[model samples]
Target: MLLVLVFSLLATCSTAEEKAPADSTPLRLTDVSTAEAFINSAEVVVVGFFKADEGNGFKEFLAAIEEVKTLPAALCSVKEVWTNYSINSDTITIFRKADLHQENLQLSKIKKLDSDGLVRFLTINDIRYITEYNQASAVGLFQSKVKVHLLLFANRGSTDYKPLKERLGALAPRYSGKMLFVLINGKEKANERALGYFNLKSSDLPRVGIYDGESDKTWLMAPGEISIERVQNFCDSFVTGELQKEKQAGESEAKNEL
Candidate 1:
C-alpha cells in the first residue's frame, strides 16, 4: 500500500508540465530545516513533494494554488524532507497547524488530473487555526475531522474584532484537534442565523461559544468579558465533560423541584 502511494509523482507524468499561471510562485524547500520552517510559518501550507519541479502535478499544483490565493505553497524535491513526512516519493500534502493534520494528495491515484481537481484538494484541506466563517471556508471547517468548535462572535469592523481574533488564533494551537476556533462576523447578514442559533444578537457581540458536533449541543459562555483565562476555562470544562455534567445536574435539580 505504502509503495504504491510513494511511487514517483514525476515518473507518472504522461504530459509535459503545463505552464502554471503566475498568480503565486511556489517556494522551493531544499532541506528539512527549510521545510520545517515553512510548515510552521503559516497556519496552513501546501507542500508538493516531487522529484523535479516540472514533474507530474507540479504544474497543476502551482495552478491550483493560484486559484485558492489564501494558502502558501512550496515545492520540495529533497528525499530527506519527503522521508520526514513519511512519504517515499512524491505527493502534495496540506500541512495544517490547527488540527495537526497532514492531508496527502497523490496524482496517480486521482481519476482526474487537472488544475480544477487540485484546487478542490487545496480548498477542502484549507482548515486553519483561526478560519473565518464563510461559504468557501465552511466546507473545510465542517469536513474537518475535529468535530468540536470554539466560536468567537464579533462584528467585523468593531474596535475589538481583530484583536480578539488574533488572541484566539494564538490560543487555538493549544487545543489543536480538540477544538476548531472560528471567527463569526456578526455584521454579515448570513451569520445572523448562527448568532440566533446561540440565542445571541449582534448587540451581544464579542462573545464566546462552544458547539459540540457529536452531541449537537451548544454552549455559550456566561455573559462576561471574553478574557483568555475565561475562554481557556470554558474549553477545559468542555474537554473534561464538566459542562455536560453541569447541564445534566441542573436538569436533575429542576426535576426534583417539580
Candidate 2:
C-alpha cells in the first residue's frame, strides 16, 4: 500500500509538469545581431518584431509586414526584444528600430550594397552630408519636372500611424529625385508653421499634396487619399514633360538670381 501511494504521487507530479505551459523563450541576442547584419546587406529590409502578447491581439502583423517589403531599404529587422517572435518562411519582416536598440549595441556601420554587392556605409554623417548637399542644390525649391509628394500628418493620436508610416516609407525609392517630405506635426509650433506655410485650414487634418517642382506650384493630389499609384502617375507626368513650361519658368528665375 505504501509503495502504491508513492508511485501514484510521482505519476501525478509528472503529469502536472507535462501539462503546464512552458516559460516563453527569451530573444536570442546573437540571432538579432546576425539578422541585422544580414539585413544591412539587402536593398530592402522589412523588420517585423513584436511581443507575443501584442501579436496575439493583432492578426494583421504579417499582412502589414508583406506590404512594407515593396519599399527600398538595406535591411529590415523583425524580431522581438527580450522575447521570441513567430517568424516563418512566408513572413515578411521589416526592420524595427526598437528591437535594434534593445540589443544595447550601437550601429557601428550600415553597409548599403549595390546590385553587384559592392557595399557602402549609409552613416549619419553621410545622411547629413546628402541632406546638406540636396538643400544647397535647392532640390526642394526647384520645379522638378517630377511631381513632389508630401504627406503631412499628426502622429499623436492614431494607432494606425505606425503602419501608415511604414507603408509610406516603402514608397521612398519610387519618389527618389522627386521631392518627398513627411511632415510630422507632433508639435504645436511646428504644425502651425506648416499650416501657415501651406495655407492649410483646420479641415485638412490629413493631406497629401503634389507639387510641380519645375512650376513651383502645388495641387491637392488627394486631400485624405493615400493612393500610391495616383501619386506615382502624377510624378511620371512631370518626368514626361507635362509640366515642362512651369519648370523652365522656375529655372529661368533661379538662373537670373545667379
Candidate 3:
C-alpha cells in the first residue's frame, strides 16, 4: 500500500507571551489560516472537530487537552477544515511536526467523546513526537512493549544532530504507537550506566541501537554513515526480524551484504 504523507507548514515565529503554558481553554478558531498558525507553533496539536451546537463531550476533551503538559495542545471546530485531512464527527487529529522537512505524522481517531476518552486515546496510543531518553527514562523505555530505536550520541554541541534527528522524526510516525525512537546523550554522567550496559563508548560519536523490550535483547548497528535511508533500513529490517537472524549468523550490520 502507498503511504499517504501529510505535510503542514509550521509558524517560524511567535510572541514570547504566546508561549505560555497550554491554556485551560483551547485556542478557538473559526478559519483555516489561524488554525494552521496555531498547530504549527505547537509540538503536538490535538484538534477537536465538533459543531458549535454539538454535545459537551468535545468541550470536555479540549479541557483535558489543556492539562496535557507532555505536549503542546490546541483544538478547533470541524468548520475549520485546514486540518481536516479525515474529518468526521468528534474527530480528534494529532498533527505532529517532526522537523524542518515539514513532514507531519498525523494520528487521528473518529469516536472519542469526552475528556476521559481523550486521555485514554493519548495513553493507549502512546503518541510522543520526540522520544528522548536519559538515565531517568531509560528503564521505562526498556519496559515498554514497543521496540526502542535509540540513537546513542556524545553530545549535540559539535555534530549536526538536527538532520539525523529530523530523519528519526520522519520515521517515527510510520511506526507511531509501535516503536520508541529515542536519543541518549552519552556525555551525561548519569547516562554512563546505560551506555556501558549497551557496550557503547562516547568516542563512537553517533551510533544506532535497537532494544527489544519484551525479550530484553539488543542489537547494535556497526558505525557508518548516519543517513535517513540507513536508519530506515535498520528499523525496517529489525521490525521484520531479519536483522536478528543476520546477527546470530555472525554477519556485520554494515549492510546486508548477502
Candidate 4:
C-alpha cells in the first residue's frame, strides 16, 4: 500500500470548515467553480475525485467520513475539476485552508483500501481547534494561516491535566481565526526540544505561553494559577496590543540599561 504525503502551499489562507451532519454523505461536486468553493469553504475537507459510479475506495471513504463528522467531505465525479488540483487520476484529496495544504491519496497506487485505514488517515490529519503537539501534528500547526499560537504546556498524567486541557479547549474557539491553540505534553520525551525552546522543563509546568510565528517571538505567561479567566485575559491582551506594547517597553528598558 502507498503512504500518505501532505504537501503545503507557498502560503496559508482560510475560509472555515463546519461540522457535517450525522448522515455524513459527501457533497456532490459538479464543476470547477463549485469545487473551488468547497475547498475554500472550510479549514479542512476530504474530497474523492473519480470518473463515475463513485469509483474505488468511495465506499471506504464514506465509512471514514461517518466517523469523522468534524471534517467536511465531498465527491467530485467531474474530471474537469481534477486538473485544477493537478489530479490526473482517481484520487482522494484532503484540503486544508490553514496552510493551503493539499494531500492526495491515489487509488491506483493503493493495493488495498479499508475503512479502518482510511479512518486512521483522516483522524490523524484532522487538526482540530485545540490540537496536541506531536511530530505528526506539527505538520498542520506550521501550515496554519493563523500565525500566532496560544500554547498550553502540561504533563499528561498530572491531576490538573485533563481539566486544564478541556478548559482551554472550550476557551479556544473564542480566539478562532485570530489564534491557534496548541497543547504541549511535558511528559513526552520527544517534546524535550520544544520545552527547551521555551526554556521550560517538565518541572516548570503547567504553564501557558504565546508564540508569534510571524516574528518568531515567544512569551511565557506569568507563572501562577492557570485559570480560564487568566488564559482568556492573556489571549485578549495579545489581541488588544498590550502584549506588543510590553515587548516594546522591554526593548526600551534594555536600551536604557545600555
Candidate 5:
C-alpha cells in the first residue's frame, strides 16, 4: 500500500508541475531549521511536501492560493524531509501563528483540483482566517489591532443563520486585511459574558455588532432584520462616524446582572 501510494503521489506531482503557472512562486525549504523558522515567522502559511523530482501539486496549490489577497500569508514547498517528519505522500498543511500542529487543516492524498474548487474550500473552511466568536473569544477580539465586526447568531448548527453567514462570508474577503470578521453564537453558554457585555439577549438573536478595538467601544445594529445591504451600510456608517451613538435600552439584560 505504501509503495503504491508513493508512486501515485509522484505521478500527480509530476503532472501538476508541468502545467504550473509562472507567476506562482512557492518558497523552497532546505531543512528542518528553515521550515521551523519560516512557519514560525509567518502569521499564516500553506506548507506542502512533495518528492524531490515531483512538484505539480505545489504549483496548482500556489495558483489557487494566490487568488486570496490577505497578507502575512505565504506558500512553502518542502522536499527530502518526509521520513524525518513521518509525513507520507504530498500533504498540504496550514500553519497559523506559531503553532506547528494545526491538524484540522492538514490535507493529504489530494485528488486533482481546479482553481475554483481549491479556492472555494479555503474560503468556506475559513483557511483565510476569519475568527470564530464565543465567550472565550471576546478578549482576543477586544485586543485585536484591527476593528471587529461580529455576526451574532442563535447557533452554528441552526439553518436560521445561513442567510447572514452567506452575506458575511462575501464581505470577509473584501475586508480581509482591514478588519476582522467574527462569528458568535449568541445562545451558547460560553457566550454569556459576551452577550452581557454587549447588552444583548436571546430575543435580539441574529444581529451584528461592531467593536472598535482602538476605542474599546461597541455598537449594535438597530435594524430588526439582517441583509447584505443593511450590514454593509452599517459597516459604512461606523467607518464614516455617521452612525448615531444613542441606543434605546432594551430588556435583553437580566436585572440582577445589570
Candidate 6:
C-alpha cells in the first residue's frame, strides 16, 4: 500500500523576554509573505529548519516531517511547523515544501476505514484519543488474567519506536484480551501524576506504562526495550509467579474451609 505523507509547518520564534541561549543561533522566518501564500495554496505545509548542531537538529526535523507522511487523509489539511531554536527577527528562514500531488497519491493508497474501526485501530496503535479529562482514567490494558487500568503513554518521536510498536502489536493476536497502551507526554500533568506513582521519570518525550487495576501498581516498559518476546515473557513471569502466588494465598482459607 502507498503511504501518504502529510506535511505540517512547525516554526518557533524567540520573544524578547526569552533570550537566545549561548552557542545556539536564533532562527528567523524570512519569507513570511511567500509562506503565507504557500500555506494558502497547499493542502498541507511543513516549513521549519533546525540548526545543524551536534544534537542532530536536522535529523529530528526530518523525522517529524516523516511522521506527517503516515498521517491519515483526514489530518492532511492541517499544517505542521516545528523548530528547536527560537526565531529572532534577523535570522534567515529556510523552508522545505512537501509535494501535495505526491502526498495525495500516497494517501490514495491507504485503505480508509469507518469511524469505529478507525478509533479501535488508533487505540490499538497506542495513539491518544481522549476527548475529555475523565476518559484518561478509563481501563485500557491487561496483563495475564487481570485487567490493567492505566492511561496510555507512547513515545512516537523516537527513531527506534517502530520496532517496539510492532512487537506490542503482535500481542493482540497472541492475547485476545484487552490491552491498553497509552501514549504519554512527559510534560503533561496527567502523565506526570501517573509516572510519579511509579517513581519513574522519562527524559524522553514518549514512553509506555502498565498500571494494575486494584492496587494501582504501575510497571513501566522502557521505550527501546518493548518487544513481543520480551513483553510476553515478562507477563508470564509476573502472572504465573507473583500474581498466581497472591491468588493462591488468598484462596487458601477457602480451600481449608471446604
**Number of the predicted model whose TM-score against the real structure is largest:** 1
Model 6 — TM-score against the truth?
0.35
Model 2, range 105-175, lDDT digits (tens) per residue? 12212243122211111111111101111211122222223334454453334564455555555665565
lDDT of 5 by residue, 1-258 (tens): 323312322222100001222234566777778777866664455565655434655565666668743422344344444555566666655554411234223345446555676555443333323455532234334433454454544555567765666577676655554566666666556555555556677656776777655555567777477776777778777666675343314333423343
Which lDDT tens digits does candidate 1 get at residues 63-160?
Answer: 88888777888888888889989977669999998888898887778777899988877866777778777655666776778989999988877899
Residue pairs that clash (backbone atoms under 3 angstroms), model 1: none
Candidate 4: 10-residue stretch with minimal lDDT: 1-10
lDDT of each: 0.78, 0.36, 0.54, 0.75, 0.52, 0.34
Off by over 4 Å in 1: 1-23, 251-258
- lDDT tens digits, residues 25-109, model 6? 2223345444455444422233333232322233333343343332221111112222222332111122212111111112122
| Pairwise lDDT winner, candidates 2 and 3 | 3
**Against the true structure, candidate 3 has what lDDT?**
0.54
lDDT of 4 by residue, 1-258 (tens): 001111211111221224435447789998999999988786678998877765788788888888878778998888778888999888888886433468788988988788888876775566656777754466656665677889898988899988898899788868767888878888777666666656788999999998887777766787899998999999999999898789666955533432
Error of 4 at 160 (Å): 1.0
Return whichever of 3 and 4 wins on lDDT.
Answer: 4
Candidate 4 Cα misplacement greater than 4 A, ranges: 1-51, 56-124, 251-258
Name the lDDT value of residue 2 in candidate 2: 28
Each model's TM-score?
Answer: 0.81, 0.36, 0.53, 0.63, 0.47, 0.35
Over the stretch 1-258, how does candidate 3's per-residue lDDT look in tens digits? 001100000111111111355555566766777777877775456666655534556566656676554445555654546444445554555655432122222223334356666665543333344445532234334434454545535355546555666677677767655567776655555555555545666766677777665555667776788777787788788878898888767744333431
Q: Regarding lDDT, does 1 or 4 come out ahead?
A: 1
Better structure of 1 and 2 per TM-score = 1
Q: Which ten residues in a row have the lowest lDDT in candidate 1?
A: 8-17
Q: Cα lDDT for residue 16, model 4?
A: 27
